[model samples]
Target chain A: MAQGMEIRNLSAWYGSQQVLKEINLPVSPNQVTAIIGPSGCGKSTFVRTLNRLHEIIPGARVSGQVFLGEVDLYAPGVDPVSIRRRIGMVFQKPNPFPTMSIFENAAAGLRLNGVDKRRLAEQVEKSLKLAALWDEVSNRLGQSGAALSGGQQQRLCLARALAVSPEILLMDEPASALDPAATLKIEDLIRELKKEYTIIVVTHNMQQAARVADQTAFFLNGELVEYGPSSEIFTRPKDRRTEDYITGRFG
Target chain B: MLHSYPFRKLLNRAVTVLMLLAVVLALIPLFSILWHTFERGWPAISPTFFTHLPKPVGETGGGIANALAGTGLLILLASSIGVPFGLLVGIYLAEFNPGGLGTVVRFLNDVLTGIPSIVTGMFVYSLLVLTMGGFSALAGGVALGLIMIPTVTRSTEEMLKMVPTSLREASLALGATKTQTILRVVLPAAIPGILTGIMLAVARVAGETAPLLFTAFGNRFWSLRLDQPIAALPLQIFTYAISPYRDWQTQAWGAALVLVTLVLVLNIVARLVFHRDGR
Candidate 1:
């Protein structure tokens, strides 16, 4: 089952240069939440903080309370490795492991966890189907993941992320590197995935937020300006900054 | 003052021809060495030359079978010691620590690579030969292994660094520990480059004569024991080439040819094996 998340007074910094301010947001379960903003607005950093991926960078720090379904992710006993396993991430670029085959890429997470052969095969097939790439690549599972086209590679990455069966998926500009058709396909996959996962996607494309997200939050200079239902945020933004951003007045 | 399109094109062609000529000039010495070796060495390369040990001075029919076996054994012993030690140090520098101690280790490694091989031989001579009370193949292997360490470590570190940070991040994102990510993803991806480095180190140490002079001490007959002085191709070649006997001089050329061919074959085999597995 999908799990919701609550962020209370979350702030992040890279060597004392604060990139995310005191941001409090509630992410609903089994729904897509889109974090939209201009460049360098801390949208990417915000999602990375949820999965504890932000702290991996040298000198990067986070002072925040992120509750993943009642457990404080930042609590002393909670391990970041376990938190990451429950919250899968997809990056901006399509980074399929070049040394790995298509099937191996999808099964990487499970294999690392020491899953056996028979169950690993079943989970790989299921994940590939979930990512909507099984029909195109089912025959050539032994081929290198890098041999696929840009769109296919992105889908393969998605399959890799989904194979772990995480409750929440964090996508940082997942479709930005893809073409129009590939972007649309990813949008469709996101909408489909919202039924089983709590997805928080950070995107610069506002139209994508409107299409795939159930709720949208607008960020500006590390601050959350406004947030509401996608229709309300896009058409009737409550804050002046949010209105200007969606109306094409300023990014 | 700018030239017209046709004039610039002509200048480009002139520069291309100059580069081609330079390449041919660079290749001349290499081709000349191969031709010279074949010319002087071919007639001496009989079946018995490989199967029989060196005959007494002035004798005509003999082979460098002992030297060939000794060189093989020394390389095997050196690699067994060097490759694993170098690989671990390389992994530490590349993955675990890139600052502090890693910086110091990297600098020392570069300096070690530049140090004279004879100095390495002398150091091993004092440390192993003087302690063991005599020259031995074990001492020679230690000297060669010391020479190989820096080469293998530097190459392995460079190859590991070439693996993109994105791949490491990908593996980590899947909840794999740092050890798992390196062993499974980073190391496997860098295998071809690391193998090339190993082959280069092996080729370099195979032809070394200066280090073995004090360590192995050049045995005249077949000796398989590690504690005994061993015969090697370079040592035999050096001894035979300077002798007054005309027949031994011819055998020296044959031994040189064999040594060169072994290094060449090692490089080719490594390339073929890794090239297939890398993809």
Candidate 2:
């Protein structure tokens, strides 16, 4: 069973510029939660803080606690590396390591963690299959990851993250750079993955949220305006700002 | 303002011709040097030119065998010291530095690169020769290695900087430590560029005669010991080129040709090896 995540008074800042306000939310286990907001509304920052990736940026600081099950990720003496290992993230852009072949890219997390070579082949195949990339790239594992199409490379990155078997997967606009067909494929993958891993997806496309998320959160101007079931949030948002934004009145 | 079609055509043709002339002018010196070296150095090249040590001033028919071997040894020693040190400093500047120490090191490296080769030789002479009591291959290699450091570091920094931050983030996101991220992803991505930098540094140092003048101090016989005075191709060429002996001068030209060929071969070999590995 996948572990659930809880965010408590989570605020993030890029130097003095606060990107995410004191936002508290609950992410259920084995379900997809989508965060939708306009550009610069802190949707990305919110998800980044969930996995402690936001602090990787210089001068980017996060305040408040993120609990993965019973453990607070921000607690003193907690290793961020271990936190990251248990919680995986995929970026908006498809950034498969260009120097590595498809096989190596898929196996990166496992290989870097010093997993034994004996089980590497099986794990790589399993991860690729989970990401739905095995059928397309199974024969050309030796080819450079960059040689794959944009959607395929993104999936390869997904496989890389999945190979580590993180309990939670955080994706920040994973399909924004992809075409419609590719976006559909990624949406399908996200839906499939939520069965095994807790997922937090930040997307600009509200329809994508409606299609993939079981629960939806609306953020605006660094504040959470609404949080509820995707059906309720999309069709009958309680907050005026959420309704205005979802009705395409403004970003 | 739009120009007339014919006038634009004429101007384009005139500019094209001028650019072509400039390109030819640029090629002239390069081709001329190769042509002259080939013409003058070809006759001196023989079986004995490679296998035999230099003959005495009044003698004829000897090779720069010792100098060739000495140059090889010096480069080997130099690369062993310079490449790793430079690579580490480069990695420090590119990946770990938060600003204070990195800025100072970068400035010092820039200053080091600008120092004249003779000055570098003098520095090494004072530091190594004066302390050790004599010029030695060790001192010479140290001099060349110092010269190589700045070039290698700058190139390495530049190459590593070109690796996208996204790649680093991706690796880190996968739970790889900073060191693991660098070794497994960042360094590999930047390797081709770094190799080019290393080759350029090696080529630049290979032709250095000033640094070896007081360090290697030119021997006529083979000496492989690091602590002993040694011969190098550039030092031998300088010694022979200024001498009154016609045979020795011919040998210097031959050595020059050989040195150029060696650097060229090194570059080509590096390219082939890196090309095979990089993709």
Candidate 3:
């Protein structure tokens, strides 16, 4: 069974400047939770903090309790590497290792985790199929990952992350760079992935959030404006800022 | 159609003529050197030129086989000593700490590169040659190695910097350690450029005679030991060119041609290697 994420009083800073203020949210298991906001609203920072990726940047710091199932990820002496292994992330832009072939790109994380070498090919194929890219890339697995088109590259990145079988997947504006057709395909893939892994997506497209998310959280100026069911938040938002944002009013 | 202004057209034609003239003037020395070397040295070319030892001072049927072997050995020694040291320092500057320490080291490297080759020769002559009590191939290799360090270091740093930061993030996000990410991802991406840099550095050092004049001291006999004096191609060419004998001067032209060809071949091979799979 997949596990839920519980974040409490999470705040992040880059040197002296705080980016994400005290934020609290409950992300349920096997569901997609979309965080939507305008530009510079700390949506990206919030997603990065989930798996402790933000702390790697020079001068960046975080203070919070992020619970995965019953385990505190930020507990004393807890390794960020282990936490990241359980929570995989796909960035906003497609970043496949240019030196590696498509199959190698997908197997990178699995190899890092010391997965059985004999099972690597099978695992890579399974992850690519789950990402909806197996048919497109099956014949050209030997080609470099950078040779693929933009949409295909993004899907390959998703496959690379999923090959490790993480319990949760965090996507940061995964489809913002894609065309309309590709965006639709990615939205469909996200829908399918939510059935197995807890998914959190940060997006700028309000229609996309409404269409794919079960729960949505609106953020503004580093603060959590509102969080609730997708239908209630979009159609009957309690906060004026959330309504204005969803209604195309000064987002 | 828009009418062409007569003065503007004349100005454009004049500028074109001037640029063409400048290019031809710049090419004059290159063509002359090639023509001179081929004309004067072609007679010296034979199978024995690559196989036989140099004839005595009064004779004219000798070859520079010992110089060729010595040059190869010298370049090998220089590469072994310099490439690894330069690459490691460059990696540290590019990846580990790019603060005050990196800046100071980079500044020092630049100063080293700017120093005249003869000055470096003098420094090596005073340090290793004087200390070792005599000129040896080891001293020449040390001098060339010193000259190679800055070139390789700068090129390595530049190549490593060209790798995008997103690649690093991608590896780190996959739960890899920093060392793994650098060794597996960053280094592979930078390899082609680093190879090109090393080849260019080798070419620059291969034709250098000033450094070897005081270090190798020009041996006439076939010597393979690194501790003994060795005769290199550039040193042979220099000694022959200075002699009053017409035969010796002709051999200098032949050796010069060989040196230029070696450098040209290295440059072409480096480009081909980079283009083959670096894309």
lDDT of each: 0.92, 0.92, 0.91
Q: Return the clash pairs for model 3, or none.
A: none
Deviation from native of the Cα of residue B235 in model 2, angstroms: 0.8
Q: Name the runs in model 1 displaced over 4 angstroms.
A: B1-13, B273-279
What is the Cα-based TM-score of model 3? Answer: 0.94
The TM-score each candidate achieves on chain A is 0.99, 0.99, 0.98
Ranking by DockQ: 2, 1, 3
lDDT (10s digit) by residue, model 3, range A1-251: 68999999999999999988999999999999999999989999999999888988878999989999999988999998888888888889999999999999999999897889789999999999999999999999999999998899999999999999999999999999899998999999999999899999999999999999999999998899999999999999999999998888887
Question: Best candidate, DockQ-wise?
Answer: 2
Per-residue alpha-carbon lDDT of candidate 1 for residues A1-251, written as tens digits (9 for 90 to 100): 68999999999999989999999999999999999999999999999899888888878999979999989999888988888888888989999988899999999999988899999999999999999999999999999998999999989998999999998999999999999999999999999999999999989999899999999999999999888899999988889899899989987
RMSD for each of the candidates: 1.9, 1.7, 2.5
lDDT of 2 by residue, A1-251 (tens): 89999999999999999988899999999999999999999998898888788898878998999999999999999998999999889999999999889999999999877888879999999999999999999999999999999999999999999999999999999999999999999999999998899999999999999999999999999999899999999998999999999999999
Name model 3 segments beyond 4 Å from true.
B1-17
Residue range B87-132, candidate 1, lDDT tens digits? 9999999898567888899999999999999999999999999999
Ten-residue stretch with the least lDDT total in model 1 chain B: B270-279
Model 3 residue B173 lDDT score = 80
Top-TM-score structure, candidate number:
2
State every prediction's TM-score relative to the real structure: 0.95, 0.96, 0.94
Rank all candidate structures by their TM-score, best first, as comma-separated numbers.
2, 1, 3
